[model samples]
Target: MELGLEVLGFLLTALVMIIEGIAVVMSRRPMHSILFLFLLLLTAAALFIELDAVVLALAELLIYNGGITILLTLAASIEPEEIRAPRIKPDIILPLVAAVILVFMISTYKFGNVSNFSYTSLGTFILSGYGILLLVVMVMSIAAALSATYMISKEDVGI
Candidate 1:
């Protein structure tokens, strides 16, 4: 009975993620798309929790849902009138791509030994070998945020 409930919960979370993912792609407005993306990431974090990857779940919530989504929302809010207009026509390609990704993830979940995955080991490996790469990525993210802030300030100053 417990296992059944877990499976049901997992399936429901996956369904919600798929729907929100589609909504994110189909949204005509940038803000609406960002909102859907936020929800999708939240669901992804829940999925991680279901998989017993608590560290991953926290990182997903903090990094993607908290930081990236807020940054994107701010970027969208300050877009120029011409740029705000939706340029990409709604197409079937996005949904197809999402489906493919879902399939791939499901297959990986079924075949991969997720129980053996250790966040501590991964962290150690990254810190030992790719610490510089991680530092560079953080620097780049900070630079991007600063650039966005500068652009927003300049626009406000009528520059």
Candidate 2:
């Protein structure tokens, strides 16, 4: 039963990741793409935790979803309408490529197993000043976006 649950979790995580990748490609809006990317990071973190990679999971959450996602969202907000409407190229082979890779990963790889490495040993490394600065930037940017979204929702300014 425990092993089955781990498998289920792995499958769920993979499904979310694939959707996120497809969303990144298929979405015309930059904001939606960033949102999906955030979701992808979240799911990946969850996967890491399930695999006993707690250190990596925390890093994924902190760096990708927390810091990078806010950066992406802010960039998208800079030119909302313009960024929303992107010129999509026609007739790409992304679907086929993604499908093949997905099959290969699922078939050849084993999921739901304990990670071979020790996560605790990796956590002793201190984050550098640049990493701290990036974290601060991510927090500020997300806070600004939250305030802006609230203000826009409550009080609309006619452009």
Q: Work out the TM-score per prediction.
A: 0.59, 0.53
Q: Write the per-residue lDDT of candidate 2 for residues 1-159, one digit (tens) a residue.
A: 466755765776687678668877887877766766666676676666666776677789888978988977877688747534544432343354345434533553445554687544443443443668678889999999998788779866665
What is the alpha-carbon lDDT of model 2 when measured against the actual structure? 0.65
Candidate 2: residue pairs that collide:
none
Candidate 2 root-mean-square deviation in Å: 10.1
After TM-score superposition, the amount by which residue 86's alpha carbon in candidate 1 deviates from its true location, in angstroms, is 12
Error of 1 at 142 (Å): 6.9
| Model 1: worst 10 consecutive residues (lDDT sum) | 81-90
lDDT by candidate, in order shown: 0.72, 0.65
Residue 15 displacement (Å), model 2:
1.4
How far does residue 28 in candidate 2 sit from its true spot (Å)?
0.6
